[model samples]
Target: MIVAGSPAAWLDRAGYHRIDSPSFDLSMDSGFILDGEVYPGGDLTIREARALRFVVP
Candidate 1:
């Protein structure tokens, strides 16, 4: 699973050619805050990825 605060950047870094996901909804109740960071919605499911490089700011 991918929890991408910046989806575009994650996709580019992971070298994912396509994004195929089911249609779903995100509500405020689903939002969560971990430590001091807040996540607005659910994590993404990356069916495939290559050359993945994750860097934390």
Candidate 2:
């Protein structure tokens, strides 16, 4: 995985097309700052995402 900046930016700089991933939930690109730097902490599942999407939308 490419590590640089935020997870969202990673996608744009990926310089490729289509990721062979089972699920790429929005939460998969998150984190909690401990001191000052950023961190990755998004780990959502497909089933959970589907449920949330259906209920929310």
lDDT of 2 by residue, 1-57 (tens): 443334566577777444546565556456767589876777644532344334554
lDDT of each: 0.60, 0.56
Worst 10 residues of 2 by lDDT: 45-54
TM-score of 1: 0.23
Number of backbone collisions per candidate: 0, 1
- After superposing candidate 2, which stretches have Cα over 4 Å from the reference? 1-29, 42-57
Please give the RMSD of candidate 1 to the true structure: 13.0
* Candidate number of the best TM-score: 1
lDDT tens digits, residue span 9-56, model 1? 667778865555655443554877769898776564334445678899
Q: Which regions in candidate 1 have their CA more than 4 angstroms from the true location?
A: 1-29, 45-57
TM-scores, all candidates, are 0.23, 0.20
